[model samples]
Target chain A: MIIGEQKPFEEIWEMVKGHKQLTVFGCNTCVAVCHQGGNKEAEIMASLLRMRATQEGLEIDIKNGGIERQCEHPFFESAKALLDQSEAVLSLACGIGVQFVAEKYMNTPVYPALNTTFLGDVKQDGFFTEKCQACGDCVLGVTGGVCPVSRCCKRLFNGPCGGSSNGKCEISKDIDCAWQLVVDRLQALGKMDDYEKLVPIKDWSKDRAGGPRSFKLEDF
Target chain B: MAIDAEKIEQPKSPEKVRDVPADWKANIIAFACHYCAFAAADLAGVMRLSYPSNVKVVRLPCTGKLDQIYLLRAFERGVDGVFAAG
Candidate 1:
């Protein structure tokens, strides 16, 4: 899932204080799972902004609302009324959602309340860890389901580096050695023979180096 | 006698702190859990112990029920200080 964190309240206030009418819009998908950009969080943000406005003697009309997903147009159908009336929108979605909203409303100003972090997995309640770099190449099949692109600090493909000690990466004790994990996984699956097969140099053209990527359904 | 809905007095919204005069006292809100804090406050009242009149106690099922939004809402509505007691 896409993980994001809300920007500082002071910074958010600085960006939105000038507006007379504002709406705090949230995306109730990926970012919501992290307790950052959700409808409930948007309401809290609106309340904080309102309190700040009141304290500063500013007369800004602020409202909060959200939809299931902000990246799609169909989900926005229900939010037309609130969004149409807004002078400026403080979006509590990821970068994609913010840009999508900006594109949909050409004339109105849209501001992001969150900083898009990474594609990650929820390690535990309230804890998220990055899992994928979206390198546009699948190595997990041969790597025993471990992602060297993301898990390995150096993105090593062949085997563990000299820094691997006691199954921990040299970069941090908390991080597991990606290759060690791969070897262990392969050993468990009786696929250690595949370890001898060396992987060639990666072709990163399929990644960000080739510029923006897109996919379409040819069947459609 | 049947109660008249129209005759009932509607509660007015709180005045903004910024709008208040210079000599105005702070308006503090206390969220009290019914299991302990609320009962303690009630006991205090029974004992005729004097407390700050500016403090308004709101009863909750539990202090765990308190949300961050509730605290911000208090400030948004011009409250000076707020505390949650379990």
Candidate 2:
């Protein structure tokens, strides 16, 4: 999932300040799973903004609404009335959603309420850890389902670097050495031979370094 | 007269207890790491040490795992204060 964290309320408040009509727009997909930019969050943000505006005696028309997904145009169609009425939109979706809304509604100013963090999985409730970097290359087949490109601090492909000590990275005691984990998994799977095999230097063009990446289907 | 007698004989349900009091002294949410803060809380219990009862602890693997949403949600739900203990 694409994990994100909401920007501080004060920072968000500053963005929409002085706007006569504002909508707290939320996305119910990726950001919602992280508990950051869902319908519930939109309601909370609306309440907070309303309470603050009342205390400061600010005259603002604030509305709260959410869509199934914000990156697609069809999902946004449902919110056309609210968007038309809004002078500005404070988007609680990820960076892409905010940009999509901004592009779709060129006249209205759109502001991001979340700092897009990382591609990660929910370890448990309220806990998420980054697991992928979308490097456009798959290496998990030989690495025993762990991507060294994302987990390793140095992105080592061959083996553990000199910085690994006692299954932990030298950089911090809290971080387990990614190479150590790879080796351990390989050993458990009786695939230590895979560790001995040398992996060639990765092609940089296959990664984000190449440019903006996309996949198009000719069948479509 | 019959309705009044029936009402008097009917069993009454117990009043529900509020998790948060209307006149609350404090409403605190404490995010405690299982390794340290949770252990400390356990020790306090074993020693019978007294502390504010209003502080509710939520356990996590590490304090680094704490998310800003959890803190915000606490305040949104009427919590007065929040503390993170590693």
Q: Quick one: best lDDT, which candidate?
A: 1
Residue B66 shift from truth in candidate 1, angstroms: 0.7
Residue-level lDDT of model 1, residues A1-220, one tens digit each, is 9999888676798899999999999999999999999999999999878877876888999999999999999999999999999999999999999999999999999999998989999999999998899999989999999999999999999999999999999999999999999999999999998799999999999889999999899999
lDDT of 2 by residue, A24-105 (tens): 9999999999988997788778877865676567888888999989999899788999998889999999999999999999
Report lDDT (CA) for all predictions.
Answer: 0.92, 0.87
Off by over 4 Å in 1: B1-24, B43-50
Candidate 2 B-chain TM-score: 0.70
Worst 10 residues of 2 chain A by lDDT: A47-56
Question: Model 1 misses residue B13 by how many Å?
Answer: 25
Error in Å for residue A101 of model 2: 1.0
